[model samples]
Target: MNFLALLLILKIGLSLALLVRPFMMAPTKALNNVMSLYGDNPLIYRLYSIAILSLCVAYGFGLYEALSGRMPWNVIAFGIVSNAGAALALTALNSHPKLRPFEATFATIAAALVLCALAPNYALMSI
Candidate 1:
């Protein structure tokens, strides 16, 4: 696959992992880590998880469209912007050192998505 396709696949995979993380961590000490990081509000945590899952669904749809040869540039652009904004907001709001790596990784992924969305032809040039 080309770079664009690869990036889309990566995005979908990461989204799936993010969607599953809450469920997988719920019964473990990771939930406690989440509570410590996010606060004692279970509602907030649930809402956050729902938001991530929603984004994941959107990304999945985008990936399907892309693979079908009808790439949805608008959806991809939205994802890039939203992910970048989320990364920036998280970095600004949270000073937790442990979360920095995740924030940076998300920002990097967002940057890659933006590049793919903006210049798919150039991005896929090698193919």
Candidate 2:
């Protein structure tokens, strides 16, 4: 309904999709495509996905608190900063075209989260 809520929904959706992608596309052509670009480190890829999923779950808890007027702004802020830093690092370290879009999307979402977290209308308090 509000900007914060919308951002939370977007975050959940993207995170869930990313969490499921490896399982859904593994052993298929899509996984092959990812492997070709990022190398065939299935373990590393799955671990990365799990890490993203964990972050997403943390954000989900923050969202719940936010909706209840007890938002953990500090945790959310930390996640936003972490996501931004990761995006920058990925952009700098990876020259693969396939990764560019992923990094861009992460940066975009992180920016939106930061903006929403800072918005006066959200009225979040630091933990």
Q: RMSD to the native, candidate 1?
A: 2.8
- For candidate 1, what is the total of clashing residue pairs? 0
Task: Return the TM-score for each candidate structure.
Answer: 0.77, 0.74
Query: Compared with the true structure, what per-residue lDDT tens digits does model 1 show for residues 15-114?
Result: 6675456644464346657434544445555666677777777777876666666666866788788779878987888777766776887798889887
TM-score of 2: 0.74
Q: What are the per-model numbers of colliding residue pairs?
A: 0, 0
Q: Which ranges of candidate 2 are over 4 A from the true structure?
A: 23-25, 28-41, 122-127
> Candidate 1: which pairs clash?
none
Strongest candidate by lDDT:
1
Q: Candidate 2's residue-wise lDDT over 1-127, tens digit each?
A: 3556556667778767864566434654466575454455466666767777777777778778777666567656876887788789888876767767778877987887777667735545333
Whole-model lDDT, model 2 = 0.68
Best by TM-score: 1
